[model samples]
Target chain A: MIRMNKFIKLAIATCIIFSHSSNLYARDKLDIKGFLTIAGYHSSNDNLGFQPHLSSSDVGYKGDDEYLTLSKVGLQLNYQLSTQFELVGQIVAQKEVVVDNSDRIKIATLNYSPTSSLLFRIGRFAPRTYLLSDSRLIGYSNNEVIPNHDFYAQLPLSYVNGADLTYNFGLSDGVGTASIFTGRTEVNINATDGNTLNSKFKNLLGFNLEYQTNNWLYRFGYTQSQLANSWEQVDTAIQFLTLVSQDYPSPLVSWTEGKEFVEAYRVKDKWFRYKTLAVQYDNSIWRVRAEIGDLAADSSNIPKNKNAYVSFSRTFDQFTPFLTLSAIKTSSPRTFSKPDEGLVQFLSAQSNQNLAFGLQQVFQFAETSAYNQKSISLGVRYDFALRQDIKLQFERKHVEAIGSNLWVVKDFSKIKDEYVSLIMFSYDRVF
Target chain B: MNIRILIGLICFVFSSVASAEILVIVNKNNPISSMSKQEIIYIYTGRLMAFSNGEQAQPIDLYDGSQEKATFYKITTGKRLSQINSYWAKLSFTGRLKPPLALETQQAAVEYVVNNANAIAYIDEKYLTDDVKVVFRLDS
Candidate 1:
């Protein structure tokens, strides 16, 4: 693995030049250092609205007003490396929203503290989602709108391969401290066959558990995989929803001489199962949050998805004003079908008469993943202190989507009703 | 008890010996006497890592964004920078612990804790002058 990641980057540059000046003249050295937060946001769709090639996407987006690219970039390097041991990192350059985004540099692991309550980490991390993906990019961590126990928006959100184990026990001011965890991930996938679109490969599995205090937090997770939606790198959107459900063009029999039709398809051993319930209410002001979730899938069943979101925040003196209402309900949620015997029955007879003329022209043009979607976000943040370590933030998001992402060629089931706006600026530093 | 009660007790012991600047820091040979602003905000917010006489106190911070860290964390942990940034983003995503080791003043944190030993810090009582000792007095 690139020579053990270059010997863990030369043992983290010899433990940051032997613990930054040898603990200023070691006397039983316990030296430590911190800071690093690079951020960026400009959503129109591509995570936080699903369409990063939809694995039954999340972020209830339907796409419309778009512009303002590279929504993420990151870096958070820490070193204590002793007093038991510590060497954490979060680097990003964009692998897909929130890892350490500003332009991106997503996670660069190497932690093993052995006791403060025990901890261990390996490479490329960010899989402890829920409670806002576990402190989602720390930018003063939370004011809410998106952090209702996110199981990576539904699962398998960040990984290049992983491992994590953390434990903290018995302590309280009001039930706080008694955390537990377990993790494992094995990744590598590629997809294309939505019905013979081509390309395929699948292998993924994930797990999680968490509990926090000094305010409140809890979580549980599970992830499984059989993917190949071209292993998402950017939307092709289920190959544009099977080219609008096989672009119709058939009339009665002789459908390319019967036989067995096929254009693209792949599901095999596919599975997605998830469950979560989250909460947060840290002190020193007013900030509350809530989350609910449930999901189930088998060979192919797009009917059993659930989501929820809630937020409220107010803090001035480094500004923080927020309000959010989010939702997602795609019941019977498991899609990607093709098998009545395939070979090529005239492209499934011009693709089921073009998905029955795009599912009976649903109310006329507007959906593409249409189910039960919703959005209500209003924000404003200004956390400036630019230098003392560095931090300068700016935010503005105004969005509204009731239903979107499901347009079987304007035979709409949803899509249309968006008034999006975004402006996320930041400058975070930590060395 | 005459002559206007001895001129209000000589203006209350001359303004209590002129603005009573109580500076009694310890560990310059340990003799402990005064300390309370909630035990110096629980030894500078490592969440009371001991020392109300239980010893084990080594808290120090300044380089995590400064104005002497909003005036030494608002006169010692009254906290507000979004509650010390949501308590350090939940003590660093629940790995649990971190936030300290920032030196720049208070005479380099009392010469880096009067040269270690359960190291603790504080200064600017007119820079203490004779190498350490002022326990606590952050008001405002």
Candidate 2:
């Protein structure tokens, strides 16, 4: 990890030095551009914990204070060494829902395009999970303040450290693109118990196929990865279980045994797969788009979910009004790990019945991580000036936990099977 | 009073007919005589960066905030200026596909297209001359 950090710093420093030198000497070969999105939102229910996306922490809305968690600023630099080689870097500063503020390099890549049809990129690149994955953070490029959270939130990794190859072919009157990419990524998960889980995704392999005509686009993508569990999170769970089981009078399960059980059932390395299909038709006046995604993990601890959304918008002069309906459903079977019958019987014989109950609660908490939600959003985007836009959006979301409450915050008792409203305003521009 | 009204109506009709039309133009040396609306849309939007003959093509645009430029895009691509800018923002920041080169005026765009056989541009019909060939025209 230390070596990787040093290498990243060196790469960033090199890019910055090259960019400056090129600007001073080869000015015509360097280009600089940037984007900004300033946004604020208010939720109707003060106690409602709203997570902007799956990767984000829940922002608690209380009292009359609106949240500016969605605001972002980014700058990109492109330096062309020749017709076929270029170096590109982008940095972004934003306020995260969990972490207060973060500034990091979003993408730093060296590109080689030998011909218009074939291109190769190395270094860190955004994971091509969806149609807008490449530009998902740039609000100026999207009609909505953000992409549909129901579909986009399921993506855990944002970028990968590796390479990708893209080939474009002209088919009749349309253009088709085929891309294959592989990489590895590490994600930091802030667990509810104030512990951070370091999840590592390895052997990432993905492919995307897209076809675009003058007015229509169709895309299909698939990705599969293996996740190595975080030992810190597993140890925390095991320690908590051991403390609960200490009251038992019989042979108490050792911490190592508890760790082994948790790893076998929940924390071990698991295969994760994601698939998506999307289509869009935009004729400058009327725009319609639809996307469906499926996310699955082989382990029962991780819930397999399906998400889909459809949106329609019409442009009238400078104003565009749009409507979207999105839904997510978890199909994982609601079955708790049964306390080993022999252990339960032995505990009963020893009159340590409470230990058996404690064991069941652990499995029940694991089931609560699955989500079931649906939302409808209405928004209007007005181009008030050149290269600038203002958007107002309202979303009414309904969340239900068939088995357990996944969307709720620390206190699940406050809300369940209820509707919440979110009102958002954003100013986006490109400079 | 009737005579004055008739004269006013006649003037309005004449002015409407005199309104400028946008013409897509290329160098006369280029072999392509004409292009379809879809083809022009693709070229201007950066989807097709090359001509049918596999030669690199550069599309030139009038300076930002120009009414003629706005009208040309609205008529040819069915998109307002702001939408087009938004579209280009995504492509530019992600794929490094820069928008068309914007000149100071329609005259400069015409001059650019006239000089470079690989360049294509749009200008008012009145600007058409022997130096450039009009491949497609959109009436105002």
Candidate 3:
């Protein structure tokens, strides 16, 4: 009797999942779906501070943890408010940030589709950097490196906390549903200089353009953030001191890049603009990808260096082998950069471009020719999937060079360009 | 030529034709040319959406997890149950498309398909009827 009851319960649950309700017959409406993946993996290269936090390779210096973790479980809600309007929201529970909590609100935003090719979205959302922005940390179906980077996600400007506009041009027929974007994002952050630097995240405007066709897709975005001016920074320091003496805590939530708060709170003000460019192409058997980006204090004063990488993937039925040769001409200001270039500077540096070379494999129980899911991946990708929606993948990489802000901190143990890794695994059925 | 060898060859041809029995199929008076075996496979597998006359065709299958369902999978798609499930699972998970609607039994499904001008249903050659046209035949 007990066995029969358990079987019945299992059947009911499966039925509920397979026959879930969704919107139909409406141009603008809501469509919801979800994914769940769980897998086990181990690796030799403990990512430590050299890698993103999403991969099994990111085992840090000293800690006791599990050999396997629940990779990711989350739900996504997409609503078509109108023919030209949509709202997409996603929530995930990752092992790092939402470790103790299962109820994590990862993304919530509204998108307006003016045409089959144009879109405008606003709110907190995925920055859409790297390869797996749309695929996320689905571990079971991707190369080991993709989920690792996307899930162990560095603190990147990929997602801005404001508004974005995107445009796509291509046939809506053959390649399924694919789109690209050329949009701008508005954000506010604390500058390294004492002044707020226009109170707009170092006062930088994000410009991005993207495209996806039958076999290839690409995106390039630029943002300008004003660094602190030495003189104005001094003045702001004096004002902040006065405010403190008059009994007020600091009102600024985010601050300037490369400058730390001292007794007098002095800082420098300069403009740093970051440009991110990425491209990927795929055929039936072979695939290739490349990304390049930079953070400049201006066109001429590009003190904060950036880097890029290119990798190739080959698929053999259920198993895929990947080999990547990546290089960074300049230092990774973000991954190898410091935390307090003020809030704006820190974010500007990390998560954009840092370079390294690693090899990994993915195991998909079923063929995953189309997309990555939490259940479609294994190894580092699986772990990344666990934290798919709400995650904080970071490492404190220490760079030791003369006349450099990162050098001044001198936490030599975890220094070098930060290396991040992640993984996700899953199984699902939709009807 | 030996007389016995010639007789054997004639018997082989006769048996081949005997096994290739013609079956009748019915749909509510839709004008379509005869379908090849490959074309029927495409229709049932959801690959080719239109009929020979450029009309949108809807092919129906029995509800999965039944005897008729297994038999159809073996003959129509030449795939095992697991392969079909995985195929549908991959498509559905990616949010691109869904499997066709299922019915409870072959008889009920056949009745519905015969009544709908755009519908298609499969049956064994032994059950040939005057109501429908023979668009395709199974080889194995």
Candidates 1 and 2 compared by DockQ, better number: 2
After superposing all C-alphas onto the true structure, candidate 1 shows an RMSD in angstroms of 19.0
lDDT of 1 by residue, B29-105 (tens): 44455676655554454444545556555666544444545655655554564457556644554334555566766
Runs off by more than 4 Å, candidate 2: A1-28, A64-66, A97-103, A190-196, A228-231, A235-268, A334-337, A341-358, A402-408, A413-415, B1-19, B27-31, B114-117, B125-133
lDDT of 1: 0.45
lDDT comparing candidate 3 with the true structure: 0.42
Candidate 1 CAPRI assessment class = incorrect
- The residue-by-residue lDDT of candidate 3 on A1-431, one tens digit each, is 01223323443464365443321112215456554443322222232222233222223222222222334444666666664566676665444322123225545667765543345666655544434453444433344423333222322333335555654332342222233332333222222111122222334345556665444657776655544344443454344323222221344233232122222233344555556777788653466877766654432113345555566666444334555444323342221121222332332344242111000000010111111111112221111111121112211122222211211112424333432233323332222
Looking at candidate 1 chain A, the ten consecutive residues that score lowest on lDDT are: A188-197
In Å, what is the interface RMSD of model 2?
3.2
Residues A145-197, model 1: lDDT tens digits: 22322223334344434556665443443222223333433332111112111
Interface RMSD of each: 11.9, 3.2, 9.4
2 versus 3: better lDDT goes to: 2
Candidate 2 structure quality by residue, lDDT tens digits, A1-431: 01223333443444344432211122336777777777667766644566566455435454333434566766788888897898988877665432222226767889998776677999887888778888888887887887786777656465778889988777888978899989987765544333345677888899999999878999999998888654554555555454433334446442335434454445546788999999999988999999998988876556788889999999998899999999888886545334445555565566545655556666765666666889999999998877778899999888774522323354556545667788888878776
Give candidate 1's TM-score: 0.32
Q: Model 1 off-target regions past 4 Å?
A: A1-84, A87-124, A127-134, A137-140, A148-320, A323-375, A378-431, B1-71, B75-82, B85-87, B94-97, B101-112, B117-120, B123-140
Which of 1 and 2 is the better model by TM-score? 2
- Candidate 3, residue A389: how far the Cα is off, in Å: 19
Worst 10 residues of 2 chain A by lDDT: A19-28
Residue A202 of model 1, lDDT score:
44
